[model samples]
Target: MTPLRQRHLTTAILLTLSCTIAIAKTPVATGTGGAVATISEEASRAALTILNRGGNAVDAAVAAAATLGVTDPFSCGVGGGGFMVLYLAKDKRVITIDHRETAPMSFQPAVFLDNGKEMDFETVVASGMSVGVPGTVRGWHEALQRYGTMSFRDVLAPAIGVADKGFTVSENFTHLVDQNTAKFSRFPATAALYLRNGKAIRAGTLLRNPDLARTYQTLARGGVKAFYQGPLARAIVDAVNRPATAPGMTVRGGAMTLADLANYEARIRQPVHSTYRGYDLYGMPLPSSGGVAVFEALNILEGWDLKSLPRDRAEHLYLEASRLAFADRNAYLADPEYVDAPIAGLLSKGYAAQRRALVDETRAASGPVAAGDPYPFQQDASVPLRPAAVKLQQEGAHTTHLTVSDKDGNIVSYTFTIESWGGSGIVVPGHGFLLNNEMTDFDFTGPQPNVPEAGKRPRSSMAPTIALKDGKPAFSIGSPGGATIITTVLQTIVNYVDLGMRMDQAVDAPRLSERNGTATDIEPGFATGAQAGTLARYGQRWSDAPEEIGAANALVFNPDGTVTAVSEGHRHGIGSALVQKSAH
Candidate 1:
């Protein structure tokens, strides 16, 4: 058999074994060699396969991310951008890679405006003008080149096979497509791939993307330059400049050029750091609101003896802390180079202590809370403070997260996105990939900090995080839920570190997200498992979450010298947790 057929056979065997193992394992895997956790079994398998082949954490993570692009395309892919937080075991330090998509030079403050008002999200989301310069491909290349053991070609092989041979369509995938059927039909390329004979493809049917497979091959052979400078880049620019919209559809085209695509570069940045009960938390820095926001929340929670509080009491505090942190997040966090975000002040314990004083364990704060001033805590005393007026809007809660580790102990926690599901509703004609609508993440109506501007990356809540104990990676955790991502990570960490829950329990525990909104959004199970009645006495208001709060994946380095991989059990369907060697 040919190499492609061999990979297909291998994948089939792996799928059968993975199903059997997953059925017995309960979305939790324990082993010694390595561990991988993700929202898709195929993605987990891809990363595990790499780990079994001696690829390090970076290599496995890149492989997992590439496979997620194929299996979880609506949420994240080569067309989008993301943040990767890595724990370098040998160096005993944490670092981050920021590849958040950038607005084109031609974009201006009024780009999303019409007749002096911000255009409706629906009116702009499906248009080419919403597409940002894609950074996923370059970002992947950068990680692999700098830290991975395998070449890009080698690492991409599994995803290419899956795309060529096809994987089974999932129920969640079908539902997401159903929601976007009308919007997707407006683009011929998008319609051709997602719809079968002009209708949504049913779950369990095999789906293939030969075009994407070929595109991956092109990148494998020509490297990142092929994606940024050659035919693929031209095709992307063409699609953005003048999309292949179906007849009767009308939308504005983008101003992105080959130069914009060519100039896109991923940055290696410092990870935001903090301490929670002696454990050090490291996460993506500026350009993402997740890291600092989560750090700030954790610092506030540090003042409470959550380990001694009742479930409702501790959870109420978590909700209040999140509210305060988001208040600051909306006001001060953005792309650091563009916005002089008081990063030092925001992460300072003094700032958190002052903010924490606003929390009342007995009564919840009312309304959208105002942002706090962190300028006093700034290390640079002479730096002026920006006004802390608050105005906020929600972002699409669709994205993907994955975690991976190798035998050498390096860990990677990554979160990636394309803004909304079925991003831009335009697949690159023949390239078989969607372009990111990340530009829509910009605050269309905002202060100077986060407003649309040339080369500015819109603020993100994609917090990929790692927690260290005694200068070693104790665990890695992350999730995908737009603004709720910070709360998800914070709650999970709190559940594990403070409440003494196992890794699986920490991830599966009921979640609550209060982004300084008027009412707290609760997962359906939030009340059932906790002291449900008394929470309202604390003046906690409730709004039912449309579905679940977050589908998170995590890895725990047990003191016993074993690694535990955990994923969601039911949210967005059962996620997959894979280990090279299963404990059972």
Candidate 2:
């Protein structure tokens, strides 16, 4: 047999083994009432508690987000920022809140470079220079004030309780701690809190953060002002500006000030809207590229009969469409306030048709694919198309996502991040939260759309999406994978709507990512077999990677007034709850 045939035979054996192993897993749950899905069990339960207390989805989301700060601190907290895509069933509206972190007033494009060369990853990540003015607290406050029925104090109570009483550390948390012990040890506050005897505390150890509890209490009592304008804000600024004094660690501090925090406001923007198979999809708009990328990819794929194609061929088409979308993402998407992003043209079905024609079903586009001129389809046709910039460095996979829905039909999909695990490795002395390294999301060495600028929010790939069917909420889904977030979410939706899988199966299915890059990365099960050769024939380089795509959580609203929530099992501590409330 030929080498390709031999590889196929090996993959067949692997697929058989995978099928055997898959049979042992527990079945996904389905129920009625309301649903909460998050990366942590504690957070999920906290949201469910709020939902049970007659709170709307926004209230439950805030509660769950705050709880995640306590239980999954490494991924997100007050020190981070994120976007919330909210659906108010009563009003039948989709509101997207942009709480993405902004560059400090002192920021410049060259901040992450030394003598014109990009600084090493460690120098940038572990330094305060990577810190941005955190916007998550403000976002939580804004979300609650506008659409929630619960008070800030009520929503924060569970998180405060979690912080004060402590929770057992999971194996994943322990691994992260162990992995970054050196960086954590560089800062006194981080070292004191997370490390014991020069090593990470063992898994299952009940750890309490009294300082974070106090911070939560302060915010609960005083509201957003306490975090942005009070002593807590001062403490945050002080911690970020404090230099690392350890040997061989030459990373400098940041210039975040009280003004940066106080000036921060989470603005409400219209969600990016699109249609896929008669279902309306709404995603968080720029500085998040997720919604546009998904919209564009779906539009491109709409030309094909995806369900009728072979599974391998469908995967090939999906990868190509993703690449095309990511090309636009890298070239055009950015903070809308900073760039004249061609949003209209980018999402237009006409433009998508134009780009879709570039794809050859028999083979992938050879050579480096550049972004198309989408401005032609816009009303303002004078908008110029810039050459595609080199793809930015991949973001660390330390983000967290949650989806919540209440009995009243309110839904919220939120994706938050501190940029990386133990962001900046510098916890505030009294605040007990790590500062975000979100500044690193900006391009340092190029005239890219996401170049750092004073007070500008960095571009993001945090896609929180909700799909509506016949003007009724159908699904709310999102993931935490940095650059891979867009592809992961797109795949999940395709799996559910096109392939006809359950939400749980959609989230659990193998995923692939092609971020306008040369190679397409595929997860275990789907990477093997004749598909590899099929993809290779299309000039697509296949990378069989594992667990690097995303950990997506999704909730599907069934026709019988029931809901099913699924938390992908790849990440530890994932939890989903369905609470059935009686009809009034």
Candidate 3:
């Protein structure tokens, strides 16, 4: 949620009014056909290049995903991890893949604690303890092996070319590098790879990753094994376990071992899907609060007279729904393997009505709202909180997401992350990027329930979603903000379905979210200045002072069989939508 302080309201209001525009504050790409999609602009261009030459959606998606790995490396790449949701029209079915990172075998709970305290979040985030088993490779390869029509090598050729020739660094890359300059400087290898002669790489500068290119080559030949079981894995283990360059510190370095990578496997699982206003909404299951919370919010809002509310009132609804969803998330959401996530009870209309009754129309309810006793599926009767030893880092804008739907009616929405900015700033030798400090994404101390443990997945905010309206694909979208992803996406959907807006209008619409106990908005003009008093009245506390809530990219299908797409107005990620004339 937004981090606007009371004093900042004056600035937020001024910025919001001045920046509000008929056009999206960010660049958006729109097009049309029966098959519609929004992907990275560069990736979209590359995919279109492949499509015009006869590639299908799967082919285009592969190409787009690969290209994005190079251009949007800060958020995603071969080094990081993500999940993919594929809807294959030919089969008339949906498939979900869990390539999320795994905790290393050496990962133990006590390491992250500080004398029984958990304040060393900096150490957890920077040291080997924070790393998890990387999964992007396995996930991407599985999709290709199971359903893709094109050769893996062929699909990745464009990325290989870009990496080899060295594409000019985009503004987004430059900005992230500048933002995380300190973290990047902490490690010699990281400093050597990203920084140029001790200076940050600027936009338009040609950046090459010969090492990454080589890794990609290995993938082109060996598929997922190139990373999971080969030299790269060895390098990762060595890098994490090696001692820091600094003098004798009690903590040697990292704890990750080769066994972690060698034994790690990406699981193919069923998506946590539910029907929302006739649309089949499919999202990641456990470990991600996206699917369940999003469903809960939408289901609850469905009961309200949303259309009758004024714009701000609608915003209030967004805030309320967000609050309810986050409450459930903090209280019960977790890996299904570890805990029985109250998915059914949370999404049930009957249950939502009970929860909705607790919301005050005029102000936010103070403290957490009880989930109205318990539904049939909800079993554990308890309030959950991360102890003082546990610290929750606000969602980091350190990831990238893409949506690709092919002419064959195959749709894929993928979200990937390195956690935050180059992730721990520790690079493996011969690997272009650093390992993800995803362990920091989890609660590190305090309550035993929140402590890091072997085989438990950390909770994530990545929400790559697809909507099927009237039993057909309507829109596919997702974003890269921690808790805010759920809210931004919900708003976009409501704008189209309820507000009678066109594709562009719906996507470019202003956004608000209250997930994680705060109502937030990008003070329109400032894009970073946030206001929380409106939500504060509802009992949500403001903290972290949001710089950016979430960045969303979306695609909408026109009744005339056209398409419109948009990217976050405040940042620099390309968004594109395309339509095919026929199912060629």
- Which candidate tops lDDT? 1
- Candidate 3 residues lying further than 4 Å off, grouped into runs, are 1-40, 243-252, 367-373, 377-393, 446-450, 518-544, 573-584
Backbone clash pairs in model 2 (N, Cα, C under 3 Å; residues 3+ apart or in different chains), count: 0
Q: RMSD in angstroms, candidate 1?
A: 3.1
Write the residue-wise lDDT of candidate 1 on 278-307 in tens digits.
988899999999999999999999998999
lDDT of 2 by residue, 39-79 (tens): 77667767767776567889889988998898888889999
Pairs in steric clash, model 2: none
TM-score rank order: 1, 2, 3
TM-score of each: 0.95, 0.92, 0.86
Model 3 Cα lDDT, one tens digit per residue, 358-455: 77777665544443333453554655332222123444557767776665667778787878767766777666767787777666653434346786
Candidate 2: 10-residue stretch with minimal lDDT: 18-27
Error of 2 at 20 (Å): 36
Candidate 1 collision pairs: none
As a TM-score, model 1 comes out at: 0.95
Error of 3 at 536 (Å): 8.4
Could you tell me the TM-score of candidate 3?
0.86
Candidate No. with top TM-score: 1
Better of 1 and 2 by lDDT: 1
Model 1: CA > 4 A from native: 1-26, 525-532
